[model samples]
Target chain A: MSQAPSDIDDLIDLMARLPGLGPRSARRAVLRLIQKRGKLMQPLAQAMQGVADTARECLQCGNIGSDDLCKICASEKRANGEICVVEDVADLWAMERAGVFGGRYHVLGGTLSALDAIGPEDLRIPALVRRVTEEGINEVILALNATVDGQTTAHYIADELAERCAVTSLAQGVPIGGELDYLDDGTITAALKARKGF
Target chain B: MSQAPSDIDDLIDLMARLPGLGPRSARRAVLRLIQKRGKLMQPLAQAMQGVADTARECLQCGNIGSDDLCKICASEKRANGEICVVEDVADLWAMERAGVFGGRYHVLGGTLSALDAIGPEDLRIPALVRRVTEEGINEVILALNATVDGQTTAHYIADELAERCAVTSLAQGVPIGGELDYLDDGTITAALKARKGF
Candidate 1:
């Protein structure tokens, strides 16, 4: 095979490391980047550089932002005496996109996992505990995933803040516009158990 | 939704422009980059910048490189009286990966497509014809794709260089390790017509 220029190959390797991309997709992306170097590639590089230089983890909420405090944590309007706990920044972003949550957030970075040897100390649990009191938080809402580790982490956090604040979790039920026939057995059971008046 | 830092949004928009990536995947990719800013994101940004500053299309073959002539075009050993014609640089790279061809290449950049109004002049067809006599080529091999536009471009090129030299095309048949049942009808017909002695 002819030698692909080293820089181009390096870019492809780095791109392949991204979450949803593999070697084949990385190659395709690189080819497109090269073709549109002037319009897209250059702008993408500049954007990446700008983000790299400015992006930082929020000290209070563990959210990603340019400043020490994420915009949500800095906003007085969002601090409605509630703090929503999530697994990662991605989940935090998902909640923000829903536009339903008016409270501040505490990103755990990851859920507690015994199999992976991850514990509360390994995450931002200590910071979250401090934030509850420092920010005068009234309720701690666990918006964790419906996974074993996510539940374990939520239970642990609930116990930690049992006396300090009101602890709650998101209601488990059928998603909006979802079909019962296509739903998983676990989800169907949850939906049945959590059934309410129509 | 809380405002994602504008730079972060910009990066995500650029990543979504890549061939295989969508908005969700781009968000995930950007999140990963933010988390690993020092390790992966910085290097990727630098690599992209490097390529953006240096990468240019090879004047002769229309292949991507950092110099005027691509390595394949500059190499004396590859000037073996044969030129493989491919529809794009990605296809040229695929052929190189197989390591079966031992000659130079002519990248058309794209196939002739009437619907897209992509004509031979829009690609490197004129340059390819010019190379035929200028470089003392013996045969022009068409390795264009199996698409309608690909075949149409191949026929057009063959006719253009018909009297100048021998024009051949890649043999169409079942792919290696491919199952007959899974093969398309066109491929099955082509394979039967081009059946060889085992």
Candidate 2:
């Protein structure tokens, strides 16, 4: 018996690689998309193509945008001499949804993972340092996750910018080993408001 | 302050429309793609495009495939005089993952809906009746969800196909209001094996 064409199989294969989706789920998702091609799949395809054509990383703060500088990085109002350093864009978005921090953000990409051999250079640490001096940033708030690697990265960044700017971290609302993406908007708002010096 | 670029906003807006995704999660997902443009985003874009270019519904069974007929429908070994009818591809996949049913599947795309004004003509019910008579099918197993709409559709199909073939419906394992997608493999297997005549 003949199988599905190679392209459909390829699509299912790629979808299987997504987090929380297995081969079975991938097949079902592909089938649903095919069934709703005009409404769901076509638009999804157009969006993906558009993103592929224009997507790029923000040079100043490691955020993702269509240009070299993301909207937050380019905004004059966001350049309030304060930068919130986060482990990932998800964390940055969590903070944004809370609507408490008017300052710009720096996405570190990931934590300092010794076991995985991910160092400061592998993240956006150097870019953060450059932004601190070049943009005349006065405060750097560390919003890394509460994991071991997250804390290590936070401490490293604090020590690196010790003399140049006031270094701080989000306070008590963040739980132990918590990722910012999982935090409620209220908790994030409280944490940002009660941020303390590292 | 200026907002995110139009294209980026469009992509995020489209992503937000997906099941279980909101504007905040959409933004986070989009941002992650932009950050890992080379490794993750590019491949995802290509996959989506490939599927869009090649995907089509199986002419006979309404299953998504790259060809006129899906693999299950095309397979001679699968045409064992029995066709397992399901409300959705998710239900079909649940049956496949359980690996107990040897017969092929006919995906109905959706159940009958009065509130939505959906009827037999809107679903694959006519095509299913055609398949039973044309393909010499002996049995049709209804593996639909245990919802009011699902049972209603099942009864409708059974009434329509009463003369041509023996119609059976999956038994007790599926909880009320539970979708087949949420059921465990073992439960689906047991339910399929112990299916009762309708």
Candidate 3:
């Protein structure tokens, strides 16, 4: 009936909250870290600590970075009058990995959702709008997901920006309901290359 | 022709090194973090930082813990004169989730591997032997993987402890070349229940 120590229990609880990891997996992960303290666990812990101390949200692009502005937003060369608008940072990273999108990005954080009560305002839609006007962007690429919410958000953004800038989307290579995280770099690049008007 | 900034590249390089994550996946994951900085990415970064600061290896059993000794190793109730040995923490967690074993665990870190230049010393074999004699252990259960190296390591441990204590192994329910992490709780429990002399 006695409970595990508070710290261990806390760790397990927190780990359980991570995606694809349950309480059991968390326990195992914790145990493994303890066992390989010198080689794996300690280094992992140190990395976590360093990141914790320095990691922050990039003020301009919402990317997780160690500085106020993310590497992408701070780069002058990336300000090529084109902005890749994505539903999530993962999508933006996917574009970057393709190494073809010679522009910056706008991370919307999430898609519009009626079920989740998410709306355009709930996402960074307003910020995205502001960026298009302030940054003198000519093209705003909609790289949102193909999900209902994703499309809804994309349509909303496109509608809001229709009068101001050229709007396009990644080609139909991403499978329906597929997350950007699941796509290969090649597929993302191909999709981006074949983008069509929204 | 320009490369990604050094810090971003460094992050990608480190992420690519994670198991099951290649350069592509790492880049995608990092990008995801950037986009969802406020919700998913920022929280993840904070969680990683917290774990980094607090996570440490259990000196006694090689489990990850917030302190020097892991929760299992520190608990007096877990000291039941029986130590279940596993190749990885994932396996140890599988056993715990099965809720079959009442004893504590000894994480071997990994199995002996001539190809990887790994040896008994590289694993926790020496610590395990020390635990057997020092802790007055009665039984040592080998719950390693079904790989050749896992079986070889089990045999080595059995030979070392033949005269000292009861040595047993997980039963045949574990599929050939199966990893304990992939096994369901029921199967693991069944395997544990049907365990026989090594």
TM-score of chain B of each: 0.97, 0.85, 0.81
Off by over 4 Å in 2: A1-6, A20-25, A76-78, A97-103, A146-148, A171-198, B1-4, B75-79, B96-104, B113-116, B146-148, B170-198
- How many collisions between residues are there in candidate 2? 0
Model 2 lDDT, residue A83, Cα = 95
Fraction of native contacts, model 3: 0.07
TM-score of model 2's chain A, to 2 decimals? Answer: 0.84
lDDT of each: 0.92, 0.80, 0.74
Best model number under DockQ: 1
Candidate 1 Cα errors over 4 Å, as ranges: none
lDDT of 1 by residue, A64-177 (tens): 999999888898899799999999988988898898899999999998988999988999999889988888889999999999989999999999999899999999989999
Weakest ten-residue segment in model 3 chain B by summed lDDT = B1-10
Model 1, C-alpha of A121: deviation from truth (Å): 0.5
Give the range of the ten consecutive residues with the poorest summed lDDT in model 1 chain B. Answer: B1-10
Q: On residues B63-152, what C-alpha lDDT tens digit does candidate 3 reach at each position?
A: 666789888998899999999999876676567767888888998888999999999999989999999999999999999887789999
- On the 0 to 100 scale, the lDDT of residue B64 in model 2 is 68
